[model samples]
Structures are given as C-alpha cells and as structure tokens.
Target chain A: MQIVVDLTRCQGYAQCVFLSPDVFQLHGQEGLLYAPSVPEDQVQRVRQAVAACPVQAILAGEEVAAGGG
Target chain B: MAGELRDGRIVVVGASLAGLRAAETLREEGFTGSLTVVGDEPYPPYDRPPLSKQVLIGGVPADTTGLPTRRDPDADWRLGVAATGLDLLERRVLLADGESLPYDRVLIATGTRARPWPDAGEAALDGVFTLRTRDDASGLAERLDAGPGRVLVIGAGFTGSEIASACRERGLDVTVAERGPAPLVGALGGTLSQLAAVMHRGHGVDLRCGVTVTALLGDGNERFVGADLSDGTRVEADVCVVALGAVRNVEWLADSGLAAGARGIACDAGCRAFNMYGIVTDDVFVAGDVSRFPHPLFGYQMLSLEHWGNAVAQAEVAAHNMINPGPLQRPHLAVPTFWSTQFGLNIKSVGVPTYSDHVVIAQGSLEARRLAVVYGYRGRVTAAVTVDMAKSLDYYRHLIETAAPFPPPPGAADRAIAADVPIPSDVPDPKGLSHEPVVALTGHLPDRRLMVVQPTR
Candidate 1:
C-alpha cells in the first residue's frame, strides 16, 4: 500500500507514529517522517496510523506502479 | 438482528479526540459493522488539551501528545482528505479527493479552528502564531525558547490566557490586550473577568483592557515587529499571538444542507443533526465542540461548548445512542466543566455562567483569592466559577444541574460563609462593557429555508 502525507497539515502529533511506528516516524524537533509505501502485509498497521492522527493528516491506499511498471 | 447490526457501516468525520473515542465506544457497544473515519489533516487523532499548557511550557514534548488509547478499533481511515459534503439522501460522504464512502450511520464531530488575524499580510508575518494543533505549539515553543524580546498576546480567552501564563512562567516579558472590558469576559462573565484581570496584573502582565488590535506591523522581510491598537497606541514586540476565539469547522458542511454555520452544526438533545428544515435524522449524529446541542438546564438553549469534559462525555453518549435502540437512548446532559491554570491560580467553571444575570460569592472570600462565585438568573443558580477552589466545583455543579436556589444550601461548617455575601453589579458584557447582556434569549427560528423545499409529487 502507498501512504501520502501533506507536510503543511501534519502537526507532528506523533499519534500515527505511536499507532504504527514501522510506517510513520518523527525526525529532529519532532517533525513528521513516514514511509510513502509499504508491503501489503503492513496495510493494517498503516491504516491504524492513519486513524490515530489528531489532525487527520495521513493517507494510505493500494500501491500502483506509475505508467505501467 | 445480529447479522443486520454487523452489516451496518458507521462513518465518523473529524478524527478528533471525541471522534476517536466515539469510534472506540461503537465497537465496545458490539458494533461489528464496518467503520470509516475521515479527516482533513494528515495526522491521526491526538490529545489537544496539553497543546496549550504542558506543550507550551515545554514540560511534555509536542510530538508525544497522542491520546493514550486502551485498544485500537480496526477501521478504514481516510485521512488527509477533507469531507466536503454529506449526502443525507444517499447515505454517502463526498471527499475532497473525489472519493465517496457509503455509510448506514454518520457522526459529525468536526471541531473548531483558531480564529486567525484578520489582516492577511500581517498574519503571514513570521512571529504571528495561534495554538490549536501540535505544530502550532511546537513552533511557538521554539520561538519562546529562542527568547523573544517581548511577547504580545491579543484576546484573553482561555487559550490566550494560558499562552500568556506560559510566557510568564518562562520568565519572558509578556503583554496581554483584551477587547472586552476584562479578561475572559466572553466566557466567565464580567465579575470573574475582573478578578482574572487583577490576577494577570498582579503577576506582572502588561494587561491592557477594552482595546482591540487594529493592525499588526511587520519588518521589511514581512516578519512581525509589533502591533497598533484601536486606542491609537503602538506597541513593539518580537512575537504576537492571535487568540481571538474559535471558528466552527462547518464550512465543509455548507452544501450538505445541515444546519451548520459559525455557531456550529445544530443538533437535537440526543445529538442528532438537524437538517436545514429542522428535521432530525436517526442516522446522523454530532458531538464535541462542533455540535451545538440544546441544554435542558439552560432552558433548552443551544450551546456550543469547547470544554474537554463535554467533548468526551457527549461523544460517548452519541456513540451509545447511535447503536442502541430508542428505549435505551440517552441524552448528553453532563454539566459543562473546564479548568485553567494561570498566574499561580487554578480557575474552574461549572455550567454556562454567561447565561446568568447576577453573581454572588457563595463561599470563601474574593480578597483571599480563593472563592466560588455562583451565577444566578431570577434566583435560580445557573453557573459557578471558582478561583483556586476547584474542590467546591462538583458541589456547585450539582446545584447548577438541580436548578438550586441562588443563595445555595449552606456549605460545610469548615467552609461556611455569610449567606448574604455581596453580589457585585460590575459584571461586564461579553461583547463589551457598553453592550447588553452577554447571553441573549433569541427565539426559535425553524429551519424556514428547509421548509421551502417541496417533496417530490
């Protein structure tokens, strides 16, 4: 699955990080850092991260190769 | 019946603390149906109470403000996409990303946003800030740690007052400008606001009352430098915090045809959203700061509360009713409760004090800086506000709920005071001292706009 985040709206609440640390991370000064895509097996964890965000800033979806890779 | 219940789908917009709790409660109530939660921001649900206090004071790290959840509800979370509209007829929610989610039941818990500075250019300046989210606190905390020359805070609402308190706690020079005659007049009424003003002044706050910020000044690089007040006074400061108040997140529901606006989405006593025509739907419910519900204790007045306790309690009620049958449905009638720590005093309020016409010292003495002031309307207790006397709040809260007499029952022997304590006439208007009563009795206006819609022949 693919994850997309809008940095401007991301408040670094770290709720996503707490729910799915494997997918979402926090950088220095608690800035938001996350993986854009993950294997299918991790889809459930990624979805949990998305639901736990306070500001509701995380997005996830099925992976799709660009231009028919 | 179990299969039907399991087949139902519930969708909650606004992944706020209230929204998340409601979602958790739904499952706990044996809701095995599919659940979908939609939010505009990219991050998931997190705690907000600490953002203004502990996060600002640097006691707790900003990134660690996520609400402690006992367990996770496996649900589809559509984040980073705004819920643009609700199709009540179709039982679907339209997303900004061109996605539509169908649901059997919907919960509208979208909360409020900070009211930003009116001026675009000035608000865009570097040092201007508003505390509502974790990022806001982190940025402001960083600036405070950098030690600005002076911090100017406009508006003395709870959020504004807390920011100023944190500033003083950090030993940074701070100035507070309030448009109302006294600080917190909009929420607590005039008498308590005066005490709040005194508290702020006693703590060395450059407190200015009855003044509005006219303009914010910026340097050549468009960084905030100072501000100009309506009183024709120019003040120089390194940072400015606009804490005007909150704007309800109802614009997204504009096309949804729900009774949503600046006041918030109007809901029935049971938390059911009312359509534009005033019709209530069983499938759609609302909770938290976003939902304007009528309080029976306050003469069924529509109240939009920003209290933390109200949010959690109302969400649980809304969630329980959403799944339970009619006989088991209950109203969210919890007495409003909120507290603030400012200038070395703990201030707490029970009930809507603004709805009262008079305030009397019920216990303790104002001079002692520890007392409970009971607000009354026509001899009936309507609200209570306390300064460093929170332990007495629960008792007062019962008085408010029971519509107890104004003088109130005698306190414990240890806390007994003169029953005829002075009732000051210095209450200020929320709009301003020159304005009329802070709480107005506006007659009901039926959803006339909704009435105009004719059902298909």
Candidate 2:
C-alpha cells in the first residue's frame, strides 16, 4: 500500500503521528515530514493515520499495478 | 438498519469545526453512506479559538491547535478547494476546481473570515496583521517575539482587545484605538465598555476612544510604521493589528441562489438553507457562524452568532437531523454563549444582550469589576453579560430561556442594590456612538427583509 500526503494541507496536528508514528513525523517547527509509502503489514496503521488527521490531508491506497512498466 | 445501510451521500461544505463535528455525528447516528467535506484552506480542520489567545501568546504552537476527535469518520476530504455554488434542484455542490459533488443532503458551515483593514495596500504592509487563521497567529506571534518597539491595535473588539492583552502580557508597549465611544461597545453596550476602557488604561494601554484610523503610514521599506487618526493624531508604532470584526464567508453562495450574503446564510429553524425567494430546502442545512437562524426566545428574531459554543451545538443538531427522521429531529436552540479573557478579566455573555433595550445589574457591582448585567426588552429578560462573575451567568441564561422578567428576580445573596438601581443604557452602534445598535430587532423573522417591510395602505 502507498500513502500520499499533500504537504500544504498538513497542519502538524500530530494526530497522524499519534496514529502511526513510524509513517508520519513532524519536522522543524511547521513542516510535517512523513513517509509516502508503507509495507502491507503497516497499511492498517497508515489508514488509521489518514483517519486521525484533523485536516484529512493523508491518503492511502493500493500501489499501482505493475503492468505499465 | 442496524448494519451499515448504503444511504445517499452527505456533503459538508467548509470543513470547519462545525462541519467536521457534524460529519462525525452523522456517523455516530448510524448514517452509513458516502461523505465528502470540502474546505478552501489547504490544511485539514483545526481549532480556531486558540489562534487569538494561546497561539498569539506563543503558549501553544499554531500548527498543533487541531481539536482532538473521539473517532475518525473515514470520508473524502477535498482540501485546497472551495464550494463555488449550490444547485438545490440538482442536489450538487459546484467546486472551484470544476468538480461537482452530488449529495442527498448538504451542510453549510462556511464560518467567517477576519475583517481586514480598508486600505488593501496598507494592510499588505509587513507589520500590519489580522489574527484569524493559524498562519495569521503564527506570523503575528513571530513578529511579537521579535520585540517590536510599539504595537498599535485598531478596534477594541474581542479579537483586538485580546491581541492588545497578549502584547501587554509580553511586556511590550501597546495602544488600542476604538472608533466607538468605548471598547467592546458593539458587544457589551456602552456602560460595560466604559469599564473595559478603564481596565485597558489602568494596564497602560494608551487607550484612544471616539477616533478612527484615517490612514496607515508606512516606512520607506514599505512596512507599517504609524497610523494617522481622524483627529489629526499620528501615533508611531512598529506594528499594527486590524480587528474590525468578521465578514461571514458567504460570498461563494452568491451565485448558488441561496439567500447568502454579508450577514450569513439564512436558514429556517430546522437548519435548512433558504433560497432567494424565501423557499427552504430540506437537503441543504447550515450551522455555525454561517447560519442565521431565528430564536424563539428573542421574539423569534433571526440571530447570526459567531460564538464557539453555538457552532458546536448547532453542528450536532444539524448532524442528528441529517440522519434521523423529522419527528426525532430537533432545533438548535441553545442559548448563545461566548467568553473572552483579556487584561486579566474573564468576560462571559449569554443570550443576545445587544438585542435588548434595557440592562440591569443582576449580581455584584460594576464598580468592583465583577458583575452580571441582565438585559431586557419590553420587560422580558433578553440577555446577560458577566465580568469575572461567570457562575451567575448560567442562572441568568436560564432566566433568558424562560423569558424571565427584566430587573430579574433579585440576586441570591440579596447583595445587589435596588432592582432599579442598574438602569438600562443605550446599546451603541459599532459604526459610531451616534448610530443605533448593530444587532437590531428584525421582528419575528429570519431575514432583515420582513423587519423592513411596511404595511400596505
């Protein structure tokens, strides 16, 4: 599974960090630094993180099928 | 019905505190269907109350002010986009990005934006600021931390007074200029406002009343340096904060055909949005600062409240009605309540004090800076304002709800002066003392139209 976050929409509420610390982290004072992709085993955590975000800035989905390549 | 039934989608515009809370309540009420929330700001929903207080004082970081949610409603959030229009017949919300989201029901919680200085270029100056969003608070906090020599705050509304209070608390020199006869004249009437002026001056605020800022002067580098008052007084300051009240976020609804304008999105008692022709739509609802709903207690006068408590309560009511049937639904009739902490004073108000014609001291004394002023109209208790005596406000709120008599039942301890001692004074207009009250009695209607209509000959 892959998680995508629009940086501009992130307010550093840290709810994502609270839900999935390994996937999302706060960087500096205002920036929200987070991993864009996660392993299948951690997909649930990523989903929880997306759900917990107050601004709803995080999104998780299946990786694009590897057929085009 | 016990399981997740696939009901039609519910779309909430504004993604504000009220909108988000309503969405959560819909799920809690077992409305299992698609949900979409749209917000103009890029960021997700966050708390706004702190932006004016703790955020400005740097006690709480701006970005970290997001409100804690009990549970997450997994729904599509359309951020960085705005709802441009509403098609009631088609049941679709037109987005600025050209995408239209269909909904079985829609909620409008497009709150309000901070009123900016009249001069666009002058307001754009580096040192000129208005506190509303997280970005605004963060930027202003940063400026305050830089130790500006002097801070000039225009208008003594709650936001303006709080900003001045924050500056003074930081040991910085500050000045507050109010066009009204006194600070908070719009909300608390003139007598209490006079007390506010005294408090501000006692705290070294250099309070200036009955004057207007004609022009904002800028330094050679284009940063706000001073302000020219209408009375020919040029006050030098490194920074200026404009707190001219708020402008309801209803412009996008202009073309939506809904009766949305500067006041707000007009709605019926059931929270259903009304059209230009005064027709109400069931599928569409409005809550929070964006909603102008009629209150039965205030003689069915349509009130547009910007209070925090009203937003939460109205959102919950809007949410329940969105999912439940009509019989089980209820009106959002919670008495309007708001509190402000400034200059070491905790000011709380219940009901619409400005909507009343008379005010009397129900408890404590104004001289001691601890009192509750009960407002009345035609002998019925209309509203109450408390300064450092908030506990008594709850009782007065009940009095207002029950339409208790003016000069209400005597204080509990019998400490108050004769009931007639605290006579009602004229509620001054925000524009100036010469004008009438800003919150006028529109007479048993949701819109100002009915109040203005003259009877046929």
Candidate 3:
C-alpha cells in the first residue's frame, strides 16, 4: 500500500506520529517524515494514521471515492 | 446484550467533521441500516482548522477545503436544512422545512458556531469577521489579500493568536488585544502564555494583554475603523477579526429536554445524551465539540473539547456504542490532544492543561522558546503543553493517561535536566475569560474537586 501526505494541506499537527510511529515520525518543529509504501504488517496502522490526520492530509493505498459506506 | 444489532434508520445531525466521521464509522462497523445526514449549511462537510491558518494566509482557497471521505457513508444528505426540534418520545427530528426524520437511533454532533460579538451594530460593520464556515474564511481571506492598513484581533486564545500570526506572516501590521493576563493564559496557563507573548512580539505584533476591547469604532461607512480598549488606548485598524471562541450549537434542543446549555450537550462517558433531569437516553448520542462528558482522569469532571483530535476520537467511540448493546459499549476515554502553528512555533498539547494547579518545565528551556510544561493538580500530572516540540507529546500523553506523578520522570527527555520545580499554572476562571475555555469543566466546582495532588510515595 502507498502512503501519501499532501504537503500543502499538512499543518504539522502530528497526531499521525502518535498513532503510527513505525510508519510516520515527526521531527522537531517540522513536518512529518514517513515511508512512501507500507508492508503488509504496517498497513493497518498507516490507515489509522490517515484517519487521525486533523486536516485529512494523509491518503493510504487507493484514495476512497469522495461522498462511498 | 438486549437484542441483535439490526438494520434501522440512523439519523446524524450536523454534517461537520464529527458527524461525517461518525456516519462513516457506522458503516464501517457493518450497520446496514438506512443513514441520513442533516446539516444547516449548504455544502458538505469541510475542514475548519484551515479557515484560520493557510486560508487566512492565502495558501489555499477556502472552497477547496472539503474533507475527503475514506469511504462514502451512502447517506441521504439533507443539506441546508436546519433541525428545529427533536422529539425524544416520538424518536423524530423536526426540520425547518416542516419535515420530520424518523430514526431508530440518532447522533447529535451539532458541533459549534463562532461566538459573535454581542453588539449587532458593531458586528454588522463591513470589516468585522468571524472565522467558522467556508464562506467566512473566503470573505476574511479576501480582506487579508487586500493588505488592509492594520488588522485587530480581539482575543489571545489559539484562534485569535493564529489570526494575528497569519496577518504578521502576510506582512500586514497587526494588533492583538486580549482580556487575559497574557496570550493563551486561558488555555496553556501563565508560563507558556509568556512564551506566546514573546513569540508574538518577536514577529512585530502589537500585543496588549490584561485588557479588553470595550467597543468597536466605525468610520461612518459601516466599516470597522478602530477599537477602544479598556486600558484607555485606541487601536487604529481597518479590519477586525473576532476570535472570541465558539458556542455549542444546542439551541435546537432547548425544548428537547436534553441536558444541553451554553456549556454543551451533557453526555455520559459512553456518549449517550442526558436529559435535563440527568437521565441518560438510550437511542440518542452526542459527539464532537458539542458533547460534555466527564473524564475519569480528571476526577470525572465533565469536559467539552474543541480539538480536532477529540472530535475524531469521540466520534469513533460514539459510533461504536451506537451499534453495541449496553454492556458491550465502550466509553469515549481517549486522551485529549490538540496542536497549533503560529509565529513560526509548533505548539502541541496532550491532556487537559487547564485542569491543573501547578506547571513544571519538563523538557527543554522556556527561555529558548522550546519546552514541554507538565501540568499537575496537587501532585499527579494532569496535562502537558509543548512549544516547538511535537515528539515529546506522545510521552506526555502517556503520563497523563496513566496518571503519573507531578513533574514527570526525567528519562523521557533528551535534555540533561527536566525543570521539576512546581509553579502555579495560572489558569484563569472560565467566567473571566474573554473566550470559552476550549476544554470546559461544566460539572462541580474546580476549587472543591480539583484539590492539589502531592507525591504518592
């Protein structure tokens, strides 16, 4: 699965860093750093990270259709 | 468990972030029931934090801030329709258009609205603005782009400070007038507010603390010309932004008999809405910025949080409880977290910082404008606020969740010494605050319940 963070939309809230440390890490007063793709073991956490983002800046795997249950 | 979970009409009010997330989570939890989302606003759910940040600084257009759903909830969205009243006995939601939505279960996530200036005449001025919805951001952004002579922000809370930061970032002269002793004193306490004051001054912002803006002056064109401060000074500014705070959208429930008031909709830890007499309702729930639920970590004192993290976390738990039977229901007890960016500093917080008596610098140095201040009530750590330090928040959140000792331990920090001396947190009374305390304590008095904590050993 691929992980993507929109650089422009990111506000450096770092909720993702707390939720999924293995996949995402935030530096001192800086934007987060993370792996572009996730292994099978890390996919669950990467997905959680996406939902945890305050701005919805993170996208994991294929982007879900806007407005799907 | 009473009965098997089955398909039923699930109605969610307020199509904002919390409402949208709860709807999405309902489906994720395998609820094949009919779902309907109702919102007074014409547009679908959109991000709000940006309305004060990048949108104000012109980084992105306000219209493009719609929150992308991970999966569509396939809800029958009732947009631009306000829910007038809710009938608990009939299990129906009365709409403004004379329609009623019948629901087996309902989630009230009616969030909050930007608290407006009390005076209608002053608020009607052309240059006055309050950031809450997409249209508000668009209108305010247009003024910011015009490079007004001076921008005046009335409030030094997070929202107010962010607006001032955006103005400074855009190279527009800005003045911040706050009623508190210092910027962010209502939220992060005295010490961090000092750092925030320094940061704002460093950015060439004219910040006035411990003073209130008594009146807004107009230039006769019905445009904001200046503001009269209580300290006997007048600020000449063309644009005035009111970042006072948010008021919970609970007026619709006035006759609903739910325990909702200015504080917020009162709910149990399980997210079930309580009646006026404090009886918990089964089918009705509340989440997001509008719900006030007592947190166990803070002596079960009820809290109403406006943080983005709290909204998402509370929504998931509320959604889960909606599906499960009573015994199987999980409580919404996630540790509160919030972050803000302003004046080139990244401020992050975990736990309820305002729920404390003393604060100790746990890491880094306040003089350097980089540190984590641990908040304690008595002797146990209650909350922590970190400036320009995001990584340390996880550690502090753990300490808060576990109810660790005050001053915290030294091992978590990279610095040689964690400032362990306890100083008064200096969190002001909610009544004296110009803005609503984002994390509000509604039940019980703080002085009586929030007695000081000393070391357990």
Say which candidate scores most in TM-score.
3
Task: By TM-score, rank the candidates, best first.
Answer: 3, 2, 1
Local accuracy of candidate 1 as per-residue lDDT tens digits, B22-141 = 988888888888888887876677667667766676555666555544346667877778998889889999999998989998999989888888778889999999878878888999
Q: Which residues of candidate 2, in runs, are more than 4 Å off?
A: A1-69, B1-6, B433-457
| Residue-wise C-alpha lDDT for candidate 3, range B1-457, written one tens digit per residue | 3234547888999898899889889888888889888999988777787678767876567876667675778788888899999999999999999999999999999999999998999999999999899999999999999989999999889999999988998999999988878888899988898899998999999999888899999988898999999989999998999989999999888889888888899999999999887899999999999999999998898899998878888898998889888888999988888877788777888888988999888788878777889999988999988777666777777888888888777845355354667899998886676777888877675478542322223
- Candidate 2, residue B406: the lDDT equals 77
DockQ, computed on Cα atoms, for candidate 3 = 0.12
What local lDDT score does residue B161 receive in model 3, on the 0 to 100 scale?
A: 93
Q: What value does the lDDT take at residue B18 in candidate 2?
A: 89
Query: Residue-wise lDDT of candidate 2 within B1-457, one digit each (tens)?
Result: 3232337798999777787778778888887889888888877677676677666765556766554454566678887888888888798999999999998889999988888888899999889998788788888898999999999998888888888877887888998888888878788876788888988888789888888898999887898999998889999999899888888888777667787767788888889888877898777899998888888887777788887778878999998888777777798888888777777776777888887787877677768887778888888888888777655676888898898887787756845674566566577654573222324343443454453322223
Compared with the true structure, what per-residue lDDT tens digits does model 3 show for residues A14-45?
A: 88888888767653465454554456898888
Model 3 lDDT, full chain set: 0.83
* TM-scores for every candidate against the unseen true structure: 0.82, 0.82, 0.87
Per-candidate Cα lDDT values, in order, are 0.76, 0.76, 0.83
Residue pairs in collision within model 3 = A68-B71, A68-B72, B377-B453, B378-B452, B378-B453, B379-B453, B379-B454
| Candidate 3 positional error at B393, Å | 1.3
